[model samples]
Target: MQGISMSNTMQRRQFSVLACVFQSIFVALFAIFGEFHNHEEDKHNRVHANYPMFQDIHTMINDAGRSLVVHCFGAYFGLAAAKVCHRQNTMVVDDDESSGHSSELFAMLAKAACTTATFMLSSLADHLGRFNMAHIQSSSLAGGIAIGAFANVILYPHHAIVVGAAAALISVVGHPKILEKRLSIQDTCGAHSLHGLPSLLAGFLSALFVLLYEPSEYGPNFVEQYSAIYPQWKGSGQPGAHRDLRTQSFFQLAGLGLTFLTAIFGGLFCGWVMNWSLLNQVQPKPSYEDASYYLNAEFSLFGNIDNSGHGLGSSNTSIHKCGRIDYRPLDIEAALRAVKRAGIGPDAIF
Candidate 1:
């Protein structure tokens, strides 16, 4: 059983590495061929026309920081997609004003706070007032995932908070009890709860915001601010002509759906390749245990070594150490037997 488990673990590790590499390659290819928004194209043309001498410098200064910050924060892929759809200039009416930045920051902070708070409360209720440290730690970042779609477009900080709280409740209450159980899926790392579901919720919120968007809110600069959203009215200089809210909403939802489909198909294909017999042949022994790969002289729980490199002068050497308790290689068998004798189940013994 242990050998089988180890083999599966090694296979999973290999699959993960290969999947990431292939996915990155595919994403890079897509980015190269992808269409740019009208505003983005116009901006590019303007940079080339006016800033010919410092075009490269402008690109480095303006674009590099945003990429670096997103990567550094390890933002979810879905969130990054949302950012691409609703760029800063289009998302905020007064991009030049400090109020715009302040509003965006406040929305982000509010969402994070709401998500963390809601997760803690829900967890406490679910666990009968006991908190799971792992869940708590992960929940702290769930808000960022939840708010990513509408982070820039959120009109009110409280709206961000509502989105965050809803995301947390869905993750805590719906994920384990409903999604996983009904679908018979095992989410070992809680990726669905932490990233997947929250991001989907964010996308929904983003679509809702798009539907609620009004051109009048931006006053005279509506065309300049929302050129990406309403590209047809860009050069026409008509702030009166508005983009159809339904059309924009449909596109937003469609993007989310396409992102999910691509991810799913890509993962399935990579997994299929990973399961080939040639790839599965090299299974590492003692797979899950760090002792197989690491040779550090860390503290052991089985026993303490004396100056003569012997475990309390006993011939039976220590396999590992566990706190103050000492267990010899031979004693492990006896301990298992003792545990069995005491009516302890195999799960408890292990």
Candidate 2:
């Protein structure tokens, strides 16, 4: 999604923003939410952090296992982005004969390993030796985000590592600078780099894996093992009725394409709504500047406030003492010269 300029009066419309959020949530819950298979409904009975049964939930609570909270919230944000276009059953699957304790263990370990790999690579990509705390924190979770597409079906931990590394590479290379310039759109938060691109990569990876799936490798009960992917096998009571890999792969790709389409159109519609005169108030004269909306911002930076909450102390060279507070625009050339004198590269500061 493209970033929109913030209005100077946005803070005053807080209630309206809150109401819109609630309305979206309501629509999602009531209008679009649908039935999905539970995690324990498959043959293998494999249990993971994402899908604990009722008894397991109780046990986790008694044991003070907070992992569930992290897993659920992480999965929520990752799944939320694509849930509008895909079915829950197809996205995730229950355990079957092909899966076991080893599979469950590897799945959890894969997520951790992938997350760590992505975090390290992303940090390095941002700065060779120094870590940007914000990018590191956000990029660390890209593995878990990408792995959700085939967490259960991934047979090996090394494959998960590869996927995570690829996600990190895509995110770092496709940073907002490249995307914004190429697309001619502002992306203030780097959503496309952090979330959108990685998820799209995962979708394509899922289709590739589906095409590569081998029934013989899954053993005699492959139908039961992959029933979620080929739902026709759920109760067909047949061995090879609906085992078409190409067809499944096509559907997977189709679902992914549809998801991007919906997100683009839906985002555009919302942006249009937000631009309505009644919704958007006074536009921020200087885009992306907090000073446009923040009162006494210049004063807060260099002086103490008086009882009336105004700056009382003397102003600095960077600020002008007008009838009210007036901030001098930043001196980019002077700042660059200072940075050079300090032996710090301009790229580091930027």
Candidate 3:
């Protein structure tokens, strides 16, 4: 992929941009995030004393970077796990099975194709002009991640492309906005589409692949090529010791179930811990940006700013009265409702 990119004049520019962006980001990240000497002991310590603003920018960058990192590594990890465990329970007859360079090349191709598909899917966000491009791009990689678990078993380049394209299509149709509007579920990060769905898809695909796999096509040593991870199945074995397709499929499904349960229960436990008073920071408001959270926002003239030079005060009364007209932008019906709720006469509001 690197060679192909460098060989193309048009792609070289993109490579240059990508290199610059990553280099700048990492340098900034090291300058910013590397400052935390200790977490529990030095709670009051500043992360980057030299660059106070670096922390702020770091937060924004992290917000974006987290999505990409999650998608990329998520696929790689899933694929690696699948490859290692592809023949987890199978006992193969003695034969040296090797993917050679094909395994590595397949992973590389999947990554490139998946990323390209994601970017293409994100372009639709511009067409709709509603969804966040980051969310769309991240979610679009669902197909690649799903395919990762069975990438080596996938056999052909065109098949991998189809899986990626299909996943991207699914992402677009099942994006957060669509789910929120249709199902009343507000998935903030589109994790279901990006990681959850893809992982599930991969599991199912792996099971199907195992069921349909023909050892005869690859030769007498074919069993060696698609064997399991367990040490018992590491080498040549009697036919009776080897597990069948049905068992392999069952294990694959079981693994997916285990993953699902772990995520669900783990998330629940983490949520409970995070909401605990000792661990909880201030509860975040809807649509409240990092600037607002960090108290870096400029005070709106219509909003309340106390004499202490603070940005926006947490005064509902002031917000209702002064900021309503400018910040909230009340319609006539809403204005009337507010008047009635406040027990103020229409004349007084006018």
Candidate 4:
């Protein structure tokens, strides 16, 4: 990730936008072994002695990161080349020179930074099992999108840049509570933030940008574009001014409302599809077997549940609830000592 950012920054004209896209892609691919990590008791996983498959998978994950960096680097570089070099007016003929200013860069960079931090917090939330972090990230993204869009369309570069920066700062400071033991890449990835929220901001800003920057042509197209969001309204490209203040307000609100509505539903549907695809591969938690002598019915009272079971108990390791029985409980210090004296013991309880 760092490699891509550095290389892309040198090659890409507007590094900020490329940064945002890369951030999203990383979250999407994190699932390749990022399904489990972060915890109250075991945020750091223990090393396995001879797990060749685990090592192989981990190596593959590292490789993906390097490849992602390279891919995004090339993409950003290409876009920059096209925008500055390939375009017609590459020199003196500047139409509103500040229009192609640094504000766009700042806005995109801020969004990327905030979103990246949100992804990390998302991982923590995944371990803890709370939706609050995700909700906050989504809401922040939505608000930023709206603000950026409005700024882009209604305000100048300086003002737009300032407003965008403030919004992004507010978003990055956010963190989550009520954590679960582990988090999956799917849940942690803040798609709602990067896409729907920003897209919303971009949409309104685009319209507003059109209106403020190109009023004569913008008036007609903005109305059509804004209205097309509704079923009963087929935008008449034959353009007309929004005469009534009430009509203008109604349309703006309608566009924003529909945008949010679609976003939530679309996100849920996508998550469901992905979840279904991985469902069959999911394994249930293991349970201890009853073969141990202590766990046998004959010594149920004296030995406790799994004390003297004949065979090894179930190998299931996952604990869905907050606190489950630990295979190696600290409270069993006395028993553990006795087992050491007897020269017999099993691994710690999970």
Candidate 4 off by > 4 Å: 1-155, 174-186, 192-246, 269-280, 283-350
- The runs of at least 3 residues in candidate 2 whose Cα sits more than 4 Å from the true structure, single-residue gaps closed, are 1-116, 119-129, 132-134, 233-243, 286-350
Taking all chains together, the TM-score of candidate 4 against the true structure is 0.28
Please give the CA lDDT of all the candidate structures: 0.46, 0.48, 0.46, 0.35
Per-residue alpha-carbon lDDT of candidate 1 for residues 297-345, written as tens digits (9 for 90 to 100)? 3333333333333322234544433333333343445445444545658
Put down candidate 2 lDDT per residue, 18-116, tens digits, no spaces.
Answer: 634554464456434432323424457552334333332222121112212233322323323322322234212312213346654555555543344
> Clash number for every model?
6, 1, 5, 37
Every model's TM-score: 0.49, 0.50, 0.46, 0.28
Ranking by TM-score: 2, 1, 3, 4
C-alpha RMSD of each candidate structure in angstroms: 21.0, 21.1, 22.1, 25.1
Report the lDDT of model 4 for residue 300. Answer: 20
Model 3, span 134-213: residue lDDT tens: 44446545765767666656544455656666677566555545543444433445655676566566666666776665
Local error of candidate 3 at residue 152 (angstroms): 2.5
lDDT for each residue of candidate 4 in 1-350, tens digit (9 for 90 to 100): 97776665444333334545674565456534343111322324342333222232122111111111122222222322222222222222322322233654554455544444333333323423222333333534543453533431332334444344333433333322111112212212333233333443444444344334432232433444333322122243434432233334345444444444443454445445544645423222221221221222222222442443321222232212212333321224444544554555465332
Decreasing lDDT order of the candidates: 2, 1, 3, 4
